[model samples]
Target: MTNTQLIFKKRPIGVPDANTWSIEKNPIPEPKEGEVLIQQHYVSLDPAMRGWMNEGKSYIEPIKIDDVMRAGSIGKVIKANNHPKYKVGDCLTGWGGVQQYVATTAENWYKVDDTLAPMPMYLGTLGMPGMTAYFGILEVGKIKSGDTVLISGAAGAVGSVVGQIAKLKGCTVVGIAGGKDKCDYMINELGFDDAIDYKSENVMLALRTKCPKGIDVFFDNVGGDILDAALVHLRMHARVVICGAISQYNATTRVKGPSNYLSLLVNRATMQGMVVLDYAKDYGNAAAEMGKWLAEGKLKSKEDVYEGIENFQSTYNRLFTGEKNGKLVLKVL
Candidate 1:
């Protein structure tokens, strides 16, 4: 049978828009030794995908021209051969690319319980973004009870979860998002103490007014000026967790570095970077806790699911538009 695939055409200068990809209908390759064939149900669309399309030194290799565009996906195993512990009909998550079928080794694949959450949730809160928020906040940010936590991009997947998790930890949570609806969801729905509509008002002023004692932990997703604003309002020994820089992802020029980094010295604050893959061994335990919170209704996971891989370019670009409310996923099946 033939499988539809989105191939990386050329390295993107900024965003991976219409010119970056080409579609192909190719024969599905049979699984080799220690491999399983996946009938992918959902493909994860993350801001990190834009970074992967560029050629540079990073945590992982760049997507080469003519190769299948790399993406995370959850799917059912339609066939398996030469692999122990994996069977047909097992739902799993892996870097399956933007394709209808994937034949890959079990090394990167993890079995997911579709019963606990929907299939797409596995690619969202129950998946990488959830793990990212878990480790980035609790571990790297060093959050404690009664501390004030400020999050940028608070309505997006990782940021939304970060705010909810901070609230659950007894921290006074504040969020900065784009519009009225996003800010409303962060405050009224997600239980954040304050919400800033960056599109309407000045973020630094809003943060200063909301967090008069200063920010104890800043969980930054959208960087650039927002990161600078956080730096300006840091409390003594504040932790600045650099989880992502979505604001600078599509920059044509060099990424704008924070100008207020000197505040870190004044506050004796610590700024650290976190890569989720570093905590791979601890995912199961973290997922268990997050799952319990989800079950108990203390934590919420939201997904913005799209349909069809053929519209992959526009769907991927939608992330930068600030229109999506949660984790963005594309239904491939």
Candidate 2:
């Protein structure tokens, strides 16, 4: 059998295009001892993938040219060679990259119960994005009841969950999204108290109107202008969780910093960047609590799934173009 893979061809300057990745097929190899072969069913498409493409000193290593594109994936183990923890038919999720099949050791790979949620959901709420929201809001943002929580990219994966968790904790949640539809989704579907349609509204004015009491916690995913606007609306002792900066991910120029950061000093607020990997030790406990909330209907999860590995480039473009909703997932098998 042949394994289809997307190879990293070039480091993108701005938005990645067709030239960024080259599709190739390679022979499926037999697993070595202590290794397992996974047939990936779905791979996660996240905004962070853009950062991984760049040569930089960051959280993770840059994807080298000619290597398979790195991604979080969920798959079933089809073959195991003396693997102690995993066996054939076991469903696993980890850094399986963008491939039809992967052979790897057990380290860093997690076994997820597909029965609890679909495989794609594992790549969404029950996985990295969910973990990001859980820790970013609770630990980094230090949110409390009665706080006004504002989230940029509020309709996307991590932001959506952050808003819901804030609501469940008795905070008034306001979401900022690009379009009317996404804004509506945050309010009507995700139970956000209010939403700002950044595409049509004056974001600064809208922030002033929606967050009349000032924001006590800001969970930022889309940075750039929206981040500056949110910073200007901070209440005393507010906490800003820098979960992502999707707005500047594809920029050819240097990424912009919040221009109105003086508001942080004036309000005595704190802004900190959070990396989910820092909270790795507590993932099981967090996922358990999030799972309970999901079961009780206190939380919601959404995944926007697209088909085919060949369609990867176009599907990934949706992250920046605001074309897809919620957590973006690619069905590989």
Candidate 3:
């Protein structure tokens, strides 16, 4: 059998294009001692993948040229080489990269029951994006009941979860998304109190109108102007969770900083960046609680899945184009 892989080729100055990656088919190899070969089913397509393509000192090392593109994946163990924690037929999820088959040790990969949720859902709400929202809002944002929570990119994966969790905690939630459809999804489907259609509305004026009391917590995913607008509406002692800056991910120039940052000093608010890996130890407990909420219908999980490994480049474009709703997943099997 052949293992198809997406290889990172040239780094781009702005948005990645067809030249950024190349696909190759190589012979599937056997697993060495203490390793297992996984037949990957789905790979996660996230905004963070954009950052991973750049050469810089960030949360994690950048992907090297000629290497298989890095991504979170869910798959079944088809062959095991004396691995203690995992066996053949076990479903596992981890950084399996962009490949049809992966041979690796059972270090970071975690066994998951596909019965609890679909494999794609695990890559969405039950996985990294879910974990990000859980920690970024609760731990970093320090949200409390009665607080007004504002989220940018509020219709996307992490932001959508942030809005729902804030609502469940008794906070009034406002979401900022690009189009009318996404805005409506947040208000009608996700139970957000209000949503700003950034594509058509003046975000600053809209924030003033929707958040009349000012915002107590801001969970930011799309940074840039929307972040500056949210900063201007901070109430006293407000907390800003900087989970991501999707707006500037593909920019050619330096990332735009919030010009209304002085609002932080004036309102005595705090802005902090959050990395989900920091809360790794508590993932099991958080996932259990979230799973329970999912079972009870208090939380919702959405995944926009596309098929075929060869379609990766086109599918990945949806992340920046805002073409897909909710968490984006790619089916490689």
Candidate 4:
């Protein structure tokens, strides 16, 4: 059988488009010693993928020319060789890229059970999104009960989880999203105390009205002006978790820095950035907790799935455009 792989056609100069990728078919490979052959099902489409495509200094190296486009995926084991840890028919999560099949060592992959959760959850909340929210809050943000927490990009995958988790911790959570629907989702569905539509509302004014106690924790996902707005409202000893800068990801010009950083000094607050990879050793702990929350229905994950490997590039485009409402995944199966 032939495996279809989406290869990087060229490095993107700015926002990526269809020209950045090319698809080709090749014979599927047999698993080598201690390796497994997987037939991929779902592929994660993340905003961070844009950073990984650019050549620059980062936590990880950029994807090389002509290489298979990098991604996280959930797949089923079709064949296994010399590895007792994984067997045929076992579902696993790993770097499956934008491909129909994958042949790699089983060590990097984690076994997943669809019976416990859907395949998309393995690519979403139970996967990187959950880990990102878990570690970015408790480990980086250091949230405390009764603290007023504000989150940017509140309706997206990571932001939604962050706001809900903050609420679960007994904090007054406010979310900043793009529209009334998302704001409604935050307030009515996710249990956020308040939400501000950045496109239609004054961010600082909304924060002032909602967070009468001031902001004790800021979980930032879109880190441009929204971050600046949150900075001005920080309470004493506030903790700011810099999870991502989605607003500036597609800029053709130089990325802008936060100008209101002086709030840290005035409020005696702390701002820290964290990469989810930094906590890879403890992913199991976080995943288990998130899974428990999910199983109990205390947490929910929203996924926006687009089908086909050929649609990968276009589907990724939706993330930057703010058209995607949740964890973006490409259905390769």
Candidate 5:
């Protein structure tokens, strides 16, 4: 049978619009020795996908021109050839490009069970977003009890979890998002103590009112001016966790530099950047911990699922538009 995929037809000079992608259909390749054929269920749509599209120096190589665009996906094995311990029906998560079917070795894929949680969660909390929030908060942010934590893009997958994780650790949480609906969801649904509508309010003033004692940990997702605002109100020894820069992803010009970095010196604070893959070797340990939290009701995972691979480009655009909430995924099945 033929399988469809999206390819990086060209290296976009700036933020990718609909014109940057091309679709193609090809026969599903037979698995070689020690490989398995997987039918993709859901594919993760992350803001980081924007970075991978550009030709530049990064922690990982940029997606090559005309290659199937790289992405993380959850799939179920439909054929297992020369591989032990995996059955034809086993669901797994891996770096399965934007395709309907994937044939790869099981070396890096993790087995997933729907009985434990929903299939999409495998791409959210139990997957990269969860790990990003987990390590970025506990390890990089170094959060403590009663600490006032502020998160930009607080309604998003990673930011949402970051706020909840900080809350679980006994801190007061404030979320900053784009609109009133997102703000309401952060404060009402996610239990964040307050939320600032960055689109409608002066951020510095909002920070002053909401985080009076100053932000103890700033879990930053949307960088740029929001970062500058958070920096000015940071507490002494505050940790700014650079999880992502969703705001600057689509800029036609060079990203604006954070102007308030000197505040780190005045407050004796530190800022740290993290890529979730840096901790891939220890993902099992972190997932296990997050799983326990999920079971205990201390942490919640939300997914923004879009159906069909045909809509990949438009669905991807949602990340930059601030229209998507939670961990965005495209349901391919």
Candidate 6:
């Protein structure tokens, strides 16, 4: 059978756009010894993908030219051989790349139950983004009750979750989003204490006004100006969780690092980077707690799923456009 795939053709200097990848059809390969075959149903698009296109060192290896694009995907096992854990018909999530079918070991994959939530959700809130938010805030941020917390890119997948989880931890949650719609959703729908419109208002001044006592924890998804804004409001002993830097993902030039390095010394605050894979073992525990909140109507998630694997280029570009309101995913089936 023919299997469609998006091949990484060229790395972009700026936004990848449509020319960055080439889509083609190839014969589906059968599962070999110690491998499983998955007919992928959905794939996740994220800002981190842009970084993966560039050559260099990172938490993960870069996607080289002529290779299928890397992505987090969910699908059902159609074939399995010499695999102890996964069985045929079992639904799973893994690094399936951007393709219609994946044949790989079960090591990077995990079986997920459809009864828990939609399969696509595992790629979003109940998956990497959820785990990132849980560990980044509770472990790295070291959140405490009544602490003032601020988050940039507050409506996106990871940042939205960080704000909600901080609220659950008894912090006064404040969000910084692009427009009034996102700001309104953060405050009205998600129960954020307040939200700053970074597009229309001076982010630094707005953060100062919203967090008068100073920010105890800052979850930064967008770097550059937003990171600078958050640094200006850091309280003593503040902890900054570096979840992502979406603002610099599409820059043709060098990434702009935060210029407020002195804030760390002045406030005795700690700024550290976090990668979700570091807490892979604790995903079940975090997902359980998030599940309870979800069942109790406390934790909420929004997913923006686009259809057709053929539209992968446009779907992927949405991550940098701020056009997608929540976790952007693509449905291949």
lDDT (CA) per prediction? 0.91, 0.93, 0.94, 0.89, 0.90, 0.90
Cα error, candidate 6, residue 231 (Å): 0.8
Using Cα atoms with residue i matched to residue i, what is each candidate's TM-score against the true structure?
0.98, 0.99, 0.99, 0.97, 0.97, 0.97
> Candidate 4 lDDT, tens digit per residue, 1-333?
789899998888888877789999989988999888999999999888988999989989999989999999999999989777888999999888999999888677888789988899888888888899999988898888988889998899899999888888998898999989989988988889999999899988888898888899999988889899899999999999988999988888998888999999999999998899889999998888888888788888889899998888778888887888788999997
lDDT by residue for model 3 (73-100), tens: 9999999999978999999999999999
Task: Please give, for residues 167-251, the per-residue lDDT of candidate 2 as tens digits.
Answer: 9999999999999999889889999999999999999999889999999999999899999999988999999988899999988
Model 3, residue pairs in steric clash: none
- Pick the lDDT winner: 3
Model 5 spans with C-alpha error above 4 angstroms: none
lDDT of 1 at 241: 93
The Cα RMSD in angstroms, rounded to one decimal, for candidate 1 relative to the true structure is: 0.9
User: Considering lDDT, which of the candidate structures 4 and 5 is the better prediction for this target?
Assistant: 5
Cα-based lDDT at residue 119, candidate 4: 94
For candidate 5, what is the total of clashing residue pairs? 0
Pairwise TM-score winner, candidates 3 and 5:
3
| Runs of candidate 2 exceeding 4 Å displacement | none
Worst 10 residues of 4 by lDDT: 104-113
Q: Give RMSD to native, each candidate.
A: 0.9, 0.8, 0.7, 1.1, 1.2, 1.1
Alpha carbon deviation, residue 71, candidate 3 (Å): 0.2
Model 6 per-residue lDDT at 255: 87
Off by over 4 Å in 6: none
